[model samples]
Target: MGMIDQLLVIWGEPAAGNRQVIGHLARSAGEFRFWYEDDLAKAQARGFQMLPEFPVHRRADDPYIGRYLFALFAERIPAPTRRDSAEMMTAWGVDHPDDQFKVLARSGGIRATDRLELAEYRAVDDDLSRPLEFRIAGRRHITDAAPLAVEDAVSLRREPDNTADPAAVIVDRMGRKAGYVPRQYTQLLGGLVERGVPLQGKVVRELLLPDDVGKLVVRIVSSRL
Candidate 1:
């Protein structure tokens, strides 16, 4: 399996609403950069603050508070990092206060009924300027054929009639079908294909157990021109 870089987007409060593209998380020459959509001075003037230890209002006077939250920890979140259960729990916080958190905010404008603040970013050279990579979130992987060797690169095909995911993914081998793409990525990658976008995937990992369903890890990288 190939060792690839993966991205995990942690969303802040008010999950839904108009999320302004304040900026993006990207990279250049392997250096991390948190580019700002708006000027730093302007953002500071907007009353951006991240006191997550205290109860920050989900409905605060300042609309950009959510973005400020991401700004609080922009330097810590890098691509291709693995987090354990303890870390995730710390980041998500339980019933009480939790300090470990990193999420980009989305603010709904004045007229919007619901709004949330947001912030976040990354770095890279001009050739790879856009943040085009995303990891699909799914619970299980399905297969009816024998396990493929670990790290076998495969093609991803569309499955229009898949009951579980209409935009299902069918993993392929040398031009024939091998297995289905992980459940979570179905609709997302499928939609990209429908729009005439091509895709490329690599087997990042695989683990076959004699006592249970095996696990295969496939990573889809953006091939958009």
Candidate 2:
């Protein structure tokens, strides 16, 4: 299993610049789950563990917009050859081949055109007062996916649910009205599913957020390492 180190969410509109931050993740047995609801009893009952919630900054005077969430998985990569370093101080063979081994690591942010292996959907519940459950499934092997504009992702409002007679899913990307899907990413997700890739969660647009925040929803189905 791969390790999920950090999850970052960037929110806000392009005109407003983006309000962004890196999120701290709570540890699960081998995977991590993030939800927008206030509670997590059912997920716990399903054998999924909760990592800690990322703290939110609340302002008394301002109304709250939604947040963008990013998940980072840290898979161990083999150390590069010591000679690969542009700077070399000590030579190999003396105490430990170059007294110290130092290398810079970079975070993998989604590019405009990167392939994401994922399944996305809006969270649904039996009652209005009940919590919404968003289901995400990651792909085993995904590539050439790109982040879609706010208007491009698709909306999944209602679907048959075995748990409830009239359960429904509603997602509002940009928080316009109740919820609607952006068209572009939705098509991409559908293609992956048709190809038989394993998915993690449904990738939906974050609504009520500023339209300027450029971010992509990606799923990790196969091991990249």
Candidate 3:
């Protein structure tokens, strides 16, 4: 089975004249490539997502592409201090916001749209599979399919009696328990879910079973990779 490979980002402009960094994925994965479908004229408090690992560049390309790559992924770490270098790397998350981004990519053609907007958490919890009283609250491996293929939507179930964990439990759209949010992630991811930030999940690969689908590795991708 393939591991999850996608990331979400809160779409925000670094500052004036530094907008080029928007939608500019520094690196690429296998066959997929990501580029901003349009330009951002202003800061969008809204969150955005992309496959950071998708392969979009070639062996040879514009010098500018190579120049800005470091800024995009490293979040401007080791920022060049030179007066000239700093001016050039302005759009490369030069300010260096604490937020992180992850790359969730698929092997074949990318099914995600350019926007990659994360759906609201519990968006599908009340759908057809949902029961009136919500019986399967703490269940696991209950769905035959992944939450979302291209862009994913996962429901966060807080596990209280979760002898294993208490931070958070990842459930599929159908409310099947998928996995736990790593302890490190619970602070951010768990808080997001609690605050209603749509935690999107991407199913890069899965294990198929005769009677049912099994072991769906849905990677929760986000700006905080």
Candidate 4:
């Protein structure tokens, strides 16, 4: 199976509910590499701490290289031995559950145990003509908005004045504020919007259970066709 080359490591403060890119992980020719970003210091000041496997004292310029995936991320992948492992992998669009890089990219390496997550870093020129899925962020804060249902059409609006992130792209449902696009796709989607590229969004999934309320996944496609 094919694999992604790079992923952005994002750290979020659970209390404040803010996220920032703190590092990058990459794979090239069988070797894996990881390095902290300059933003690491800012994240540290915001109550983020060095991961046990990645020391804060390490110089950002010197990347850690290894033949195997870092434990920090490897642990996020569901164990192949789990009874529902195949279902989980299929949900993430991964055919091979053992393809760690692809799984991480599709799943965002999200785990309840940590605030760290991974996002595939797509190039500015990457094609968006194909449909892609992105979980709407900040839904929990949109209490006044009406519930969204599958197949519901959504609109994207740029929020250049947003205090937290100038590149923010908000999703709207039935003319009400639903949520914002995940930060990982903001740069890409925001750039496209700036270029006057028409984009379309439709609700692909919605979790309505008490615990997973407001969790939504939207399918986005460039309307350049």
Please report, in order, the local distance difference test score of every candidate based on alpha carbons: 0.39, 0.27, 0.35, 0.78
**Candidate 3 lDDT over residue span 1-225, tens digit each:** 222222222242223211112343333443222344343333334333333553332222331243223333443232356555444333221233222221211111112223222111122222212111111122242344334442345565566675555665555566655455433234555565666654445543442222323433344533232
Residue 87, candidate 3: alpha-carbon lDDT: 41
Model 1 lDDT per residue over 69-135, tens place:
3443443332225545344334322222222222221110011222222222223221212322222
> Mind giving the per-residue lDDT tens digits that candidate 4 earns over 1-225?
235688889898878878888888998888988988865667888898888888854444688889999999988888989998887776666777767877887777776678887877676676676666777888777678667887899978888998878889889887788899887788888888788888899987643222234457787888886
Over the stretch 132-177, how does candidate 2's per-residue lDDT look in tens digits?
Answer: 1122111111132333342343333332342431332333233332
TM-score pick, better of 2 and 3: 3
TM-score, prediction 3: 0.28
Q: Which candidate achieves the best lDDT against the true structure?
A: 4
| Candidate 2 lowest-lDDT run of ten | 98-107
Q: How many clashes (backbone atoms < 3 Å, residues ≥3 apart in a chain or on different chains) does model 2 have? A: 45
TM-score ranking, high to low: 4, 1, 3, 2
